[model samples]
Target: MALDIEQVRHVANLARLALSDEEIAVYQEQLSEILEYASSLAELDTEAIPPTAQVIALPGVTRDD
Candidate 1:
């Protein structure tokens, strides 16, 4: 899913950014690549995978008074 120049401009506008033509072109390509990668990930089989909040367990850090 490649992003067009207009979409990139809209995203920049939403972020309140003022970008030059060159910057917009650069961002357009980068953002499109990210979306394409995410789209590919969405096609994977994850039915056996379980959802979790964190990958590693964290020990308690608070000290008792």
Candidate 2:
């Protein structure tokens, strides 16, 4: 789905952002691209992948005996 300028304006207002005309235009394009990329990620198949809470592997910390 494409993001409209009005939507961007609404989001900026909700975020308490005071954007200039140029800044609003730039954010509108950047935010639209980000949303489009995120949408593409939904097509991936992850049935065999296990869910993880963290990206790095580490042993549990414990006090020394």
Error of 2 at 38 (Å): 0.4
Scored by Cα lDDT, where does model 2 land?
0.91
Number of colliding residue pairs in model 2: 0
Cα deviation at 17, candidate 1, in Å, is 1.0
Q: For model 1, what is the error of residue 41's alpha carbon versus the real structure, in angstroms, after optimal superposition? A: 0.9
Candidate 2 per-residue C-alpha lDDT over 1-65 given as tens digits, one digit per residue, 9 for 90 to 100: 57888999999999999998898899989999999999999989999999999999889798778
- Residue by residue across 7-52, what tens digits does model 1's lDDT show? 9999999999999999999999999999999999999999999998
**Ten-residue region with minimum lDDT total, candidate 1:** 56-65
Winning candidate number (TM-score): 1
Q: Please give the lDDT score for candidate 1.
A: 0.98
